[model samples]
Target: MTQPAKRTKKDKIGSGLKQQSWILLAIVLLAALIDYIWYDAHWVIAKSAALGACLSYLSQAIFAGFVFWHTGYRARRHIVRQMYRGQMVKWLLTVFGFALIFITIQPLSAPALFIGFMVMQISHSWMLWRIG
Candidate 1:
């Protein structure tokens, strides 16, 4: 009898990352709509909400991509090592992302941005709970 091929660690990581991304995107869009309608239907507020949500997600996505770029093609034996490296990179990217967003986006709505971020971050926990 032939045995099924084993999946690589990279494949497992990719699938989990994809699920995370989708959850973030859905929550971001929903938050954007709520921000728009709740905040006097202002485009600025809506845009801010969307940007904040996207930036929050981008922070993680960029790091995930970096992990894939640096480790995905490497030997599977190095996965555990790569995970630690990936986490450090993710943290750095997240800090840099927030700094960049704050510095570049003028007339930014702090409340909207923070609300979007908070909602999305909270949603992540909710998602994990549901999944687990």
Candidate 2:
């Protein structure tokens, strides 16, 4: 049987990414609402927390994309190499993302931002661990 086309694989991954983005955004919106209504958090803090979650999720998604960027039936060595590349790129993206966000976003709550990032990162890691 013929393997799937490269474009097809990429398109599938892209769609999955978009779907996950939407899910994460929805979760953040719900949390924002609850924080605003129940906790009496400032709008700025909620926005900052959402941005932080997005940053964490995006960095992780990029890593997953890189690892699975080009594959059908691949050798073990190739997969390992891709994983290493993904880890390096993910680290760089995360650091740069935080730097940019902090500099550009004003009136941000550092505690909330850190909490959002940590929560999302942990959940994402747990989900992947369960699936894999």
Candidate 3:
């Protein structure tokens, strides 16, 4: 059996991102489970939980993707400008996502949606602290 090649700094950063992604997934699952128990196994609660998780994950992912793509081959000023613009677009996307969910999903449980989102949002800070 051969040993794996040593990883570069970029590889390490990629792995760290993967770890954070998994943590986000776990947070979503836990939120769903809590909602299931709190709402007596109602499907609506589960749906709301899923939607909330999707919103959080998608928003963060889109922003990260844009940053990674734009900063790859750019000057420092260009990167900085893109970062600011990316933030504005990311926030817009997030708000649009939430609005779409609320408008489309009838009888949604507000608590479930918020709880799911909040857990993932807070997990970002938790992951950063833990990683540090």
Candidate 1 runs further than 4 Å off:
1-41, 63-77, 130-132
Off by over 4 Å in 2: 1-23, 38-42, 72-74
Lowest summed lDDT window (length 10), candidate 3: 5-14
Give the C-alpha lDDT of model 2.
0.75
> Ranking by TM-score, best first?
3, 2, 1
By the TM-score metric, which is better: model 1 or model 3?
A: 3
Q: Which residue pairs in model 1 clash with each other?
A: none
Highest TM-score, which number?
Answer: 3
The root-mean-square deviation over C-alpha atoms between each candidate and the true structure, in angstroms, is 5.1, 5.1, 7.1
Tens-digit lDDT string for candidate 3 (6-112):
32244444565677678667765776687678867666777787678668767766666655544343355776776787788889987998899899999898887
Tell me the tens digit of each residue's lDDT in model 2 across 1-44: 98764432555555556656765786578768977897786676
Q: Backbone clash tally for model 3?
A: 0
lDDT value for candidate 3?
0.70
